[model samples]
Target chain A: MTDSPIVLVKPVLPALDKLGAALHEVLRSGVLTNDGSRVHAFEALLSARLGIADLAVCGSGTTAIQLACGALGLSGEVIVPAAAFPAVAQGVRRGSCTPVAVDAERTFLTLDPDAVAAAITPRTEGIVAVQTFGCPADVDALAAIARSAGIPLIFDAATCWGITYRDRPLLAYGDVSTLSLHAMKLTHSVEGGAVMSTVHPIADKVRRLRNFGIGAEGALPAGTNARMSELHAAVGAVVLGEADAEIVRRIQVREWYMDALRHTEWLRPVPFRPGAWPNVAAMAVRLRPDAPVDAPTLCDELKRDGVHARAYFTGRYRPRPIGTAGPTPVADELGKRIVCLPFWGGLTESDVMRVVDAIDRIGGGRCHESHALSLEYPG
Target chain B: MTDSPIVLVKPVLPALDKLGAALHEVLRSGVLTNDGSRVHAFEALLSARLGIADLAVCGSGTTAIQLACGALGLSGEVIVPAAAFPAVAQGVRRGSCTPVAVDAERTFLTLDPDAVAAAITPRTEGIVAVQTFGCPADVDALAAIARSAGIPLIFDAATCWGITYRDRPLLAYGDVSTLSLHAMKLTHSVEGGAVMSTVHPIADKVRRLRNFGIGAEGALPAGTNARMSELHAAVGAVVLGEADAEIVRRIQVREWYMDALRHTEWLRPVPFRPGAWPNVAAMAVRLRPDAPVDAPTLCDELKRDGVHARAYFTGRYRPRPIGTAGPTPVADELGKRIVCLPFWGGLTESDVMRVVDAIDRIGGGRCHESHALSLEYPG
Candidate 1:
């Protein structure tokens, strides 16, 4: 049998064009390195648009998280959601902290306040609450839990751009929030991220850590280089300038998909809270019980039809030692059912409709449904 | 008094036109993110040129070292030079290991072989030997020490690009060697580095660690994103492509500076071993007793004449600990006295002569030296 055509995970046309233009300027100046004019401009633009005062651009999201954690002096136990990407937990681990896995809230695939509260121990120094699928988690609630416990909270807002609650940006809530501008993000800087902090000391420390831990006028501290170059910053600047329009388009496409799948039994779109506007970074749907299909089966069928769907963050962060806690209830539940459909700035309503139609066709006992149903039912 | 004229650190005119063209293509293609065609090409070209098969590209020299340490599973005590860049020690510490600072050989200004032998304890898992100032160190000696002790040796050869020893590339002698292609290096890739290993397994592991620990076919280990973008890689490829001719020019400039200052009383260039072909990355000289100027004073005088000389790793890694065995003799001596003059592909012989003339005037205590000496050394 012929293998199905591959749909690119992220067809990053806008980023490519913007980055290309940035590269042209880099080429023109023959100044490919340094915290040059373009990089400085990007940092300023990103900070202003995000409603934050201080932002130091760095090499990648991982680097951003590492910088923040290193600066914040995160060394003991860090509470992390088992439902999030592996990078979050890994960042904590890389910073010499033990990642104490926390359960997520079933309603929204985010860190459960109760789980975070329960996981807090004398060793707990920080909490990494990821804003899953672009939906801003209950930061106010999460912050309360962390503050009362006297631990810092880091928002891995990699997926939650263009989101605001109560007229303030979602990222404005945390002590330090890390934003990723990868090709897959609503606004991309090719490969870049930033650590935003209202605290001058934290921001200053982050700046030093990002630049090999060197104080502005002194020698470097014991640290690795995590700097974002001028080319990346230039691309980030252009993307930030164009993101508003892109977000509008993404929101429209998301609405179109929601409308088409509202009555479909197999596909249940994850609910969002009122007044919580997201960038539509991804459209996630949970498989319903009465549905004739399961997530993996439906996903495989959709791929056959050129409607790419992914099991985002599935098995990304496994539970500790297998039998210890077994698994976080929310992580186990969400990992098996949630699927992310094709989403990007260039995605059209037609593409969304095609995905819905494909899912509608494959809702029956096709492919892996029998296997999934057998597992779903205990024999 | 009017401030001295600010000289451009790197007058990047030769490749400006080409860069503009590359940026134009980037703008058109919109493939702005990781391992784009340019980046892939650069990596392939670099691997072949460096004569290393197991090489993985990353965001920076610091990231590269971290990846190497991660790949090698270094989690105990890492021995490094006390007179090297702080990043070396910091990178080791970042890996959750204790950074044991060892004295370097005073002659080579590299890691002291005897110091490495002494720093080894039950916890010592590896050694990070830096090839300071683009000159290949006594790698054979360091290699023998690491091999005899049954520990891995990671050559922090960030500054040793294009240098050969014993008719073979200096990088081939170590278990794994890392190269920096930062904007400051002779042939930079804007901001990038690579880890090369002769052993296939370690190389494969290095590749995975740098890229979020995702295996070729298995699940990704929890790792950070340390990928080098195509745009940066493309720039690197162009530089590497022209490296042969570029190396010749840089070496010629090095020889020119050496000849111009052959009779200077106050500063003596660091001695190179016979058959030790250096890459001429940076020109450094020791402050002589008869000279009327110190390193800082001479640097100031040269800067006023459109030359940018820098203090070479002064107090970068120092003051080991109260009970720790103190400084490496060669590294200690050079760390205090060595000052590097401008060395880039863009600098002409005439520009070099101008720099030499400025140094000559300062050494003779003609104009700027008297003022510099007072401000720099207030005693």
Candidate 2:
């Protein structure tokens, strides 16, 4: 069934020799994990590359989010953007906090700072802002709201490792910014994540939390083995060496889709915010309301055309967004029609043209079976 | 600081050629994680080797424990063995359940079935039994208690991959048996774990929980990214081939220590259950109260002799065991004076003799400083 010639996000890895060397070093050291020297090396490299002083590498981006929530001592309600991978909300739940989802602004498709402030109640302990598809959230506005509410702000920077705004890294904001180093990300340690923050104490807490809460004195109240293995760190170190090139290639791929779909009436590319650079985790395209075919049709047609595209996060929102706030029209509209096209580095112009050719043959906006519309990503 | 020649558990890895081929295949196919083909192959291989039909490979042993609790629909208080690693209770807490730790039986240092049965209250939801240092728990008795209570039985079988009792793998009992394929264990996937069970549905639930709760149709209520990467699985597959030989070697090392220390009055080997076989995760020695310096001094002395030994789980219970039950004398006795010797596969008879020689020069039991007794596996 998965015979598609091209798929969404074919990871761009380092040269085989670099990865092999890293693996060899891990094998030689016999320190498979437990925040070993290899993990330390990767953390240092990531810190230097991202220009952040405090960071903790963990098992996955979800683990990074989990660590942040755990370190912050958050309880009660955590405000989350409706338009995100459900894992963002799951992170909150895993930390023993309730997730109160709110709508994102139409312009950037990020958490609406106004909605977030309005959603805050005495039960709210923190706010979780997600950079969807590498679209930067309004960090300054969100930070202001957090300060006013006296709640910690956590940015799920899973997709924006290289993203920047006004020449400052988008990750530099928030009490804790969690990054995904999964294979799908521009820079990954095979399967790992990091909890980055300017708040040194929080970063320290995350370290303790990841190591089963064991500190110098003794075991803390709680912690889990959310540590990155040496092998994974080796992969991350090797991958980080080529991250810049990979990010640039990803941008090029995004542009290829954008340029090819510029004149097409059936679909449109999601635009970036001003002075906000993107890492383009997913090159999402919005199917026009007047387009002949709906999202599932476009997804099905693309697959038939030997292209593997996904309608990401469409199920989490649309047909009534799942959250505290009711009637999130902007999120509903965007969520129901969004389709992430085949995107990744090393994609040729010809591949983009093939994807574009398939999209141009859109039909009338007709709904398929209800089950087909329930797209929540490889569930 | 880690310059000791004989440390606790220098991981026995597969040949470089085998590991290299496995990693090369993972690199060849771009699926680095998310239970890909490599993970499937490893799980299949593990199933065949361990003689289990239903299982799920996850991120770590802790994740395996977490998945079991989450899958069993546990919430409320959970019964845990005080003699196990602190992670067992932490896993219960991560599953949003309160850990009601009870003392293990004095014999095998495993959860006493009677104690477990007594600990069960109206609020109790499940039981988490840990196979401390590869010693098999009274599985039949524990299972019977769990069945009587109508609560699920989950064994934190982190150290008993190759261990068997009554001609059956120790993992074959319980509602769900979790394994830690950590580098310190008999067989490892670099840093991996598994949930094994005769209850097929629970195994299926664990698979979903590890995968962000996303299933064939949609998202389940709660889940986490506890996924084993393809690289890790590749490592596991290669490592499993040599696991039997590794187990045999580990058993040999255990025997060597036992033989060398047979007549020593200072410290002696902990006894194993009659029908139970051990994988020998740690060759623990109980320091006689009347013998030479306390566990810390012994540990310090071992280190001084270029043998890096550890006092595992001493801190969590020694001063005062952390759990619902108050003042557990057996746990206190076992937890305070127990020290695990430098034990692992590949330890020669020469190494055993050296360790025994150091123990032979035992002094009167003395507590130099209170700070020195806080030995808990590198904090």
Best by TM-score: 2
Cα error, residue B262 of model 2, in Å, equals 1.3
Residues A73-180 of candidate 1: C-alpha lDDT, one tens digit per residue:
777778888787667766776666777777888888888888778777788898888888877788889989988998899989886678886778877768898888
lDDT of 1 by residue, B134-193 (tens): 667677788888888899998888877788877877666688888888877766778888
Over the stretch A21-114, how does candidate 2's per-residue lDDT look in tens digits?
7788788776888778988888899889878989888888988887888888886789988777777877777676778888889877899988
Best by DockQ: 1
Per-candidate Cα lDDT values, in order, are 0.70, 0.78
Misplaced by over 4 Å in model 1 are A1-22, A199-201, A216-222, A289-298, A316-327, A367-379, B1-17, B215-222, B289-305, B316-332, B366-379
How accurate locally is residue A295 in candidate 1, as Cα lDDT from 0 to 100? 66
DockQ of 2: 0.40
- Docking band of candidate 1: acceptable
